[model samples]
Target: MVGLLVLAAFLTLADRWAVLYAEHRAADALKDRLKLTAAPEVEIDGFPFLPQFVDGRLGSVKVTVPDVSADRITLASVSATARDITLDGDGPTSVHGARVPELNGDVLLSFADLNRELGASQVTFTGEGRDRVLARGTLPVAGHDLRLRADVRIGRAGDQGIATTIGGMRLDVGDLATYRPGARASEGLHLTPKSVTRLARETRKVRALLGVPSVVRRMGVPDATVREALRNDDKLAALTGSRDFVHQAMRVNLLDLTLAHPEVLDRLGLDPALLDALSRLTRPVLADQLSLGFRLPEPERGELWLRDVRVEKGGIRVRLAGQGLAFGD
Candidate 1:
């Protein structure tokens, strides 16, 4: 009986040791895959018996990352959990209640801020199924305050291959310096449709003069509308109106505008004699239509804020002084 008891005790010790070994290995592998410089420490306790290598349960694994940096930005207190882990070769790993405490940098700018400042922001990435990324915070520009939030998605489909979508995004500009000093910074102004229409008309005329049929075609209007707009000055004028109607129309047909037209190119201001030579060189490029929206508080010079101001491939919308919002025709 004494010998048997001793053997049982030895076996129990061996089982606990094995579980600890496996848990450590898995944690190490994960840290490497994430390119984490600060390796995670794991501890395991409580095993009734020597677990089978195939279905062992990890009592607990805690991962702590102190500081992770990319360029100028540094993320502190980043952690996650794998609450319950099973050593099954076929089942997918599940993670729950994951979060990062804070991300700070000299300047952490998002897509919206970059777009507003520079007119465009281009991002390219590769990943697997329905991945979502989010960022929120404030960015200061030349004494003006700006708040930004953005959500983006990357999706994959069997037939479509890889696709990306900008789920939702918003940029709030507060305390913008109005044209007039002593003016309330929050009083926001709305961009007029007339401005949008005028720009659209100018674009079409330039496209026609350049003799670029493909350029006009890409604007997505029915060939009939393009033909009619080209032939009748009044129709084109009416369609452009004083709003963003033209901007929206062209956004839908961006892909088709690549074909070139000499007449349209000439109208863009190149000499007629040079039209033929430049025809091959003329390329279709996207244009950004300017839209402005403003809002004013009770006291006109108290505070000016710009809200619901957005520019997209299709159109622009803005609200001024809590009212008089406008969209291009």
Candidate 2:
């Protein structure tokens, strides 16, 4: 009984030793074959590995590599699990080739790394939902940094790449006082349809604009109506709350107003010199500055592809899969 127990202990230790040796050798092989800067962490699962070693088949193996530089972004982590690995040679050190019948993994693009790599425009990425990311940051506009926000949808780019589409973009006119000096733009100038609805609810700002004789004159509000609004609070509220007022305000595209009515800018205390700078900012130029498209590197053998993508709180995760993956041939 004692002899059997001792033999069992010896076998256990031997098995552990062999597994470690195999894992180290496999890691080195991967590092060299993949041209990796550092050796990847390798784990051979489903052990009592000696018998599997003899049969030249590993049931499962997991590999994790960090900080892999890609086309436009650096992948924070690249991990994969290979199944039914068939070795081409008798031993781990002697193996010159191998076959992976199935492989699955994910590449993580951490927001921290992405913010660092794509920091040229000072844009930052955050998860908006399961399949979408929110990109919010400052963009250069009219010789000043302006706030911009966009919802980016992530999807498979062809077979092996991950693609991003900017669904909608809006620029917010932060600190209206900056443009108007001592006063604020009562029109609440922002570049989107949604802002038009918001401007209607801001009765105080509308009142301020109506208070200015120049603004009321440029907007074609009657002098009698202004006098009635001043005496009757309800009338003042009704005038600003009117659908016609909202519609007209919504139609006041700053670009068109800048060209057609210099009086409007006068009420807002803006210099006409800034009109040229605003004119240069177009939808295409903003879209190009916020461009976020990239492709994955091709594999040397068999097939590799992106299966799915999800936006996580910290970053984006891309599911990857491959079949009949060959190494060291």
Candidate RMSDs in Å, in order, are: 20.9, 7.2
Error of 1 at 179 (Å): 30
Check candidate 2 and list the clashing pairs. none
Tens digits of lDDT, candidate 1, 10-82: 8887877766665576567647755777566554544552443434444434455444443322333333332
What's the distance in Å from true for residue 184, model 1? Answer: 44
Model 2 misses residue 206 by how many Å?
Answer: 15
Worst 10 residues of 2 by lDDT: 177-186
Shift of residue 46 alpha carbon in model 2, Å: 2.3
Q: What value does the lDDT take at residue 261 in candidate 1? A: 41
- Name the candidate that leads on lDDT: 2
Where model 1 places Cα greater than 4 Å from the true spot, the runs are: 1-150, 153-196, 200-255, 259-329
Question: Relative to the true structure, how large is the alpha-carbon lDDT of every model?
Answer: 0.36, 0.72
Name the top TM-score candidate: 2
